[model samples]
Target: MATVKFNPKDILYHYCSTEAFHSIVTTHSIRLSSMSLSNDSMEGKMVEEALARLAECDKCDQGTISLLQAQFEVYLKDVDGFGFCLSKKRELLSQWRAYASDATGVAIGFSRDYLELLREEYLRQRDPFLGFTIAEVMYDPEDHEKQVRPLYQQIKHAIDEGDLLEAKKHSPLRSWSNDTETQRKKSCLASLGFSTLMATLAFAFVLKSEAFKEEDELRLLALINRGEIKKLGFDVKSNSLRPYREYELKKFDQCTPVIKEVILGPKHRSPISVVEDFLRCNGFGYVHVSRSAVPYQ
Candidate 1:
């Protein structure tokens, strides 16, 4: 892997001097590569996976960003004393400035210039309030905007287009390799998230069905009343039982029973348990003994 000359602190400062920046960076931290990427082969897959996660994160962070922005606006109003408030604000500003510097340094792995460019572009679009210190605003979510998604999509597109080597030209994280256990896990998780999202979307479209006849509608109504359709929503109580008819037509009805058996069965063969067992058996670490067993397997 290529050596990173930049510092994490500097990268942090360049991108995360504000609350919005901090939130965005931390979120990416959790959803993206938790460890540095190291393997060339896994880089493309990891990048694509990271992009999908970022999209989901963007959707979830919108509400948080708005709330943070509102707090920044109302902060002064809530302060009891001017001197105390100013002191607190100053302290926060200093902390954020330092934090931003540190994070920027860390992000130097992504290519210092690229990180800076992205940061500048994001800030240019956001134009956050300049009065408060960077530290004070690092957690506020309201300042986030559309740039996050577009940037993420750009990366994703690059990966899908078979530009793996070129895409990492600016990426800070190393690609995953078998030698680096951390990178492998991070890459695997990203792949899983990408696959899951794709499955959900495809399921929504491919499995779409409609209820056209009266008999079908009555059958749906009966299923809904019987609690076969868990939630009492539009899908269940539609006039023509369109939702029910559609759902039954989909593979979910056939697959759901099996899925539930795997998920809710006493054998404990659910995805979570499977993952836990795999990790434990593979020597990642041992988990506490549980009564759970996978009888199906």
Candidate 2:
């Protein structure tokens, strides 16, 4: 989890079925769905377990680790998250099979600058605690510790100085009741600074199972309290209603397209001109479209 630098010019690819692609172009939006309802049962919690194991390996103080662990549990109980996924690799085989429709799916390449800027601007007018981030997914469990160490140290240092309670007292969480704050002095709402908690949550959502490494994903993630439900929608998947939010990154006749390129899947039947025409009609004529080079059926 060393600092991975990505240029603003980097391209992140979103893969989807032809029907999903049509809906994307028609609606000019991407969906950020809830992680709680994800296909992978061990979504955010896998990283939590990894972080705990790493903490023990570092031989952190039993009291401090236990306290922080308890706080993490309580703090996360009320937390919910949403994510929009993209990949560092374009036209990837596994990505095609898992996310995109076999051969009929397509990949849209977006400007990293455009996507990040959109989130920043959108958050300016929203709550700061939304904890929104565009991040690379970490597959190695051993690397999970790097993402949480600084925050862990911050709490540990406060405990060593016997000022953990003092610091917690000063950092009053508006959501916490007076009695609750007093009882849970070392909890995230008390001892952990907002930045520390926000950073931890961001990494938690991105540190997924290594089994999914082939996806080479870069996710646009948001960790929010279940209270601030705004513009959220639900779709029926697997006979259950899953929550999602539409992120509007493009619009017809908008200033410019955030999409830089579109790669048609290997089995795409439409001619190049027809695809280009579709872009032109939708005000994204500038986006370059090419068929994927994969030799897949």
Candidate 3:
């Protein structure tokens, strides 16, 4: 076979986010610093002892630490200016590929199992008298609590009158609410027209529940007011909903180019192309592949 040459600088790569890229570099730098400190004559034993203690505190097994150390060495050798060389990039891509494959199966299985459990829970909590399902009550745009209050009042009246059997017979589970048809129709229309909007609102509710700092929430709110969130494809309707972490919001301001270079390996496709293909195959449509003009210094 003829001799082959490779140039590390010629390989093109991009990170999912600058923070992710920075984290990789910073972690490697920290490890390199630790290795240096532990190798020095005066601090060698002390540094090693400290590291061992810290590892023990973290509950890291020896095998895991050894594997991580080996990986870090490879990372230090192959990572370069805002990207990895071809070999390292390929290695990372392989890992991501494996994860992507496994994640698809796991996600499907989890969703199916969780949905069944949710349906069962809904049925169990449903009012026996109420003709409509609990899902309808939860998702109905109208004042559901107000609608259910009268039924509870009737049940209370029956119980107070010492007619326990009557109360049970007229229980929300046993009785059909008078407005079930109207409510059902409204729910159907809402599901048809505003399903995505409702889901987005629910996601915002979950994020707000995390109780992020007021300042962070205010910053995210400002971005919402400026229509930046809309630009990012989130249809956020309220300033109260802070749907992203501080670092995630910071990534929106980033304009780093996602380097796209031809791959020379067995799969002759660029890493970016491979990612695009994976996304498309998994039903992610038309991902934006952006490039920035800033030179890698």
Candidate 4:
């Protein structure tokens, strides 16, 4: 049986199209070429000949090839115009340091845009039962708080219209006036109280309101951010939520004593900081952290 070998040019050509690759490398029994692979081997000579062809290709760039070899890693497969594949490729592309000013900016902006889309998709699919669904906390400050005001106004409008769900949708964006770490978290916890309470009292409440307690839920979220629990734990790969919840709750409990002594007292701790300090003191170690808290209004 004859074994076909890969052409380096083929690899380069497929890569340049800015698309997923369709070619597959078959792993069959290795057949030695009529040429031996040794330096003196015909197999080696033939492979070298193929590589020379690729090096001399007029369309190829040594600079681009070197950049790819040094920095880029690809996961190519046969999928065309597929959103998931495109997104995955874009994520891989984001790690590269783009040097051209226009290209660099576009690359950075696209990475952020794709990341937000993924986050929104996850949140939509998870249908989280706890935490702030408010608008202020979610708005990006890179846009200079312009996004938050409109979102907060929408929440206000929703409140006036008696649209609780609509209000929940805008609640996470409420961190605009929150200028300190403590304030932002306290505000988030305070807001969650209404979100949880309304859900419990008005709706059927199949999900336990107790599990949605401000402290507990915040701890779980903190653990997730810290990578103590799988970040995707909320996505529920397992049928039972109890195990993941219990695991996070246990970690949270371990931090409680430190939280009470080291964080809950003076120095005006932010809610997020309190959680972080508590976690850090309880074996996670020191983490440099900062967050915006709302000044006293």
In model 1, which runs have C-alpha deviations exceeding 4 angstroms? 1-53, 57-138, 141-145, 165-297
Q: TM-score for each prediction?
A: 0.16, 0.75, 0.16, 0.15
Give residue 213's lDDT in candidate 4 (0 to 100).
22
lDDT per residue for candidate 1 within 14-40, as digits (tens), equals 212223222323333211110111112
User: Best candidate per lDDT, number?
Assistant: 2
Q: Write the per-residue lDDT of candidate 3 for residues 1-297, one digit (tens) a residue.
A: 222233333232321223333342233210011111111232111222223334455576784344333322322232111101112232233322332232111100011122223234334544311111111102221232233233323323333443433323343346434576544533442233233322322222112111211211110011122222321221132353223212110111222221223122222223556545643553333343322222211
lDDT of each: 0.26, 0.73, 0.26, 0.23
Better of 1 and 2 by lDDT: 2
Summarize candidate 2's per-residue lDDT along 1-297 as a digit string, tens digits.
Answer: 122244435888998888878877878778888887787787777545755675688786676566666556555667767888899897688888777777788898887867767776667755554435788899887677777777667656656655554444454454444666445553643545777776776677788887899888988888767765777788888679988777776432334357888999987788878878887888666678899998889
* TM-score of decoy 4: 0.15
Candidate 1 at residue 247, lDDT? 12
| Candidate with maximal TM-score | 2
Runs of candidate 4 exceeding 4 Å displacement: 1-142, 148-228, 232-297
